[model samples]
Target: MATGESRARSIGQQATGRTVLKTHPGSKTAVLVALAALVTGCGGSASDTAPTKPSAGHRAGSGSGSDGSSAGTVGFDTVFKTEERFQQALPDPASMAGWTPRNASALIEDDPEPAARCAPSRDWECAKIAHGEANFEAFGEEADFDITAFVDKAGAGEACRKEATWSAKYTKAPGAAVSDVESHAYYRNVGGENGLYVTMCLGTVVAEVTLAGPNSSLDPDTAHSLARQFVPRIQKAAAAS
Candidate 1:
């Protein structure tokens, strides 16, 4: 009886060991799949949290800045138009008094075109005189004169002279020397606002005249009528320049 029992126990133990060996490979594969799932879950969550970049079109409107506040549209055309209108308001040389007739050869001399008939001295020249509508440009020379300072000297007076304003001097060519010759004067009919008289030193002469209507008290209707007639001609002359 004891021998039979021992043999049965040995058979049971051997069967149990064989079953464990057969299932070992499948258990390892299951554990590996679970580990792979855990790693995939962590990776997918990180990807979802990443920040997105803006589209190219959106970035362009934001200008060239990290904070998106530096870009805008510029109105270059409007600025240019304003400048053109100001230029058009300037006076013309042919309409001024003391100016000679249009003569290309006369300009070759050291004398200014209007001064051709007058004596030529250092900074001393003559200007032609013309009146109508009161928009004209007179040409002459000045010696040792500060035009800007002169205009400032005039201050807000109705008729005074000290220095010339930028509006008066900007039209001339560079290196065109001015002299002080009190022999010349700048006159503007002003069309009733009141007239203006600008007198400079002897070597200084009147170069241009831009009338804004007579003095302030003049008739507005008459001034407007004159402006309408004169502004067109002045504009045409400036355009030729």
Candidate 2:
């Protein structure tokens, strides 16, 4: 959980209209406004207009994430499989880690919408990310990635639009790609959940792992460290078929 002092400092900063990330905030401010009126993390993402969807990057053709991709296909079951994969992808509170890693309370499917929005009257208005179509294949139904991780798809030219479209300052985590059509992996605080969210985007395929404590934990530093440690492993597992 966030230390009382730390929470006070964060509240002070936000009250002044200043953000936790100032220099490298993405293109827009992202706030994960949920069913409650909560202002979460803020970061930058891609532009407003939807970019052209790229080819399916995950192992859709092979029918499993561990089985390297062959034919052009995309789906969650193949990308996210074992519960261990999901567990290892985030911090483990059961092991005395800062937060408990579990399947997201809700899963977001891939959509080609330009932006994430909410009705002002819904008490849930925030700068959420929205994305467009992809050039990949779906795992028809037997897929299990959906069983493990929450997925979100977005297109921003030749980049991991889903990762780029977040409201946090993203430092390059280890093993993240360095290319035009590359994946951008990162993590940041999610205030509403009182934790941090780790996002790994391999083009159209995105895995969202939240590390939050039941006790209102807000450990951004731990979140980043955990993300740096786990994202690479997840990527490797995704590649190892």
Q: Which candidate is the best by lDDT?
A: 2
Give all TM-scores, in the order shown: 0.16, 0.30
Q: Score each candidate by Cα lDDT.
A: 0.21, 0.28
Using TM-score as the measure, the top candidate is 2
In model 2, state the lDDT of residue 102: 18
Tens digits of lDDT, candidate 2, 1-241: 1011110111111224543422213223222211100111132111221222223541212211221213222322334423333333322222211111111211122221223332222221122222111111121211012112322333212123323544335443344332222334343444543433445444233544343434424234433333343344445444545
Show where candidate 2 strays beyond 4 Å.
1-159, 166-193
User: Number of clashes in every candidate structure?
Assistant: 35, 19
Residues 61-105 of candidate 1: C-alpha lDDT, one tens digit per residue: 111112112111111111111122222222222222222111110
Q: For residue 62, what is the lDDT in candidate 2?
A: 21
